[model samples]
Target: MGLLFLTIFLTDFFGYTDALLRFDRVRRKVWMFVGTRSPIELDWDRLTPVSQGITPANSNVNTFRSVLLVDLDAEGDVKFDGKYPRIASIGQTSLNEQQAISQYEYVRQFMELGPTHLPSCETYLEHRTVFRDIVRFFGFLDLARNIDWRRPGETGGGLLVLASILCMLLGWAFLPFDLATYIAYRCNRVPKWPAKIEAYAKDGGEMTTPVGAASGRMRIVLKEVPFILLWVGCAFAVYAWVASWFIK
Candidate 1:
């Protein structure tokens, strides 16, 4: 029934097609609604992609969390502080690498062309990837299914529980980073944050600066001694609490 309603009336937004857009030509902005949450409005004048790249996915490597990082000017008018620019990331748990790239391309193209961009797919792959990313969200059920009481065997239950916990941790930890990136970008508060994340993925990060200094300042603020200490402290505290639940 929900799907039916969306198809009949909200298909454009769900399909991520031309219909999702609400343009005010005089204002020179565009809107996108993904159905489950409030729509996102974009002001083309203040948009720019600071960087775009992805890390390879691998199960054995804890650091192999795939990501695409982008910087935006949040408020879309002017920066209050020269010291602060904004950053947001997209990751594999939320989307495969291909989908993140598509997002960049779409936003980049949309800003470049104004509302006339009209949400297009250059190829079938592009369409398939978008729909696939949207559907992959439902994949979270797999974690819950693993926790079913009907299941037997320590290995199965424990592994699934651990996977679920890690998933939650990933989101919790990403929250600050993601919030820092988009909170100031839009005109109104977004209902749900962007699921995109640039996973830490590899040993040393690959970051490019399109308009600002070479991340030295951001590193000091986001990754330097003080923040890193707080992050590590919180992570250990959470791990200890969760471990206590199962150590017995």
Candidate 2:
């Protein structure tokens, strides 16, 4: 049992850390692509380039394309031409300047409307906050609250606690079965008893009536059996260790 605990502690600790690092790296890449300092300030304008090409139909009329010009720098500057020239200002109302303005306006609107109808900064921040919250919640739910046998603080402190507990459990017991059940629980596989009760209450009907009651009762056995096995294994291991010492 001691050996099992040790094994479980090591594997779970390292595996969880590895997974977290991988997630962090992917998140960073996503932020980088979106032109945000963190996941919190994504500005679409900074990420996407303004349009410079003119439509085939508008090619004949230089003024027509010029009329579509947009002022990106807010100084009424930054003009575009057929060559897509990057210039300082859109001076003098000409066909080229108009075209540049049009392109800028088009790109600006596109950025503004994309990504949940939020500005670059707001969108990025919202997404980051949501992502962080979800990950944190699940980490707590899976690693902190749900244990097969051991207590919460049995594992090391900090982020290692979850990993350590996981390792210890896996090393000392038949972890595959326990792990499957844990997964199911996290996925909310339990039947709809709560929904049924709420419906009855709303209708002024018998709120005590069971809805999906049979399914919930049946799943309890599957949910609890692993914890029992874990406890029994741990106890037997402790007894054997003490017995060995006496023999020696």
Worst 10-residue lDDT window for candidate 1 reads: 126-135
lDDT of 1 by residue, 37-128 (tens): 55455554544543343345754433222232223445454332233322233323323445655655665554456435646332231111
Q: For candidate 1, what is the total of clashing residue pairs?
A: 8
After superposition, the stretches of candidate 1 with alpha carbons farther than 4 Å from their true spots are: 1-26, 29-43, 52-84, 87-97, 112-248
TM-score of candidate 1 to 2 decimals: 0.24
TM-score of 2: 0.15
Highest TM-score, which number? 1
Cα-lDDT of candidate 1: 0.39
Task: Provide the lDDT at 113 for model 1.
Answer: 64
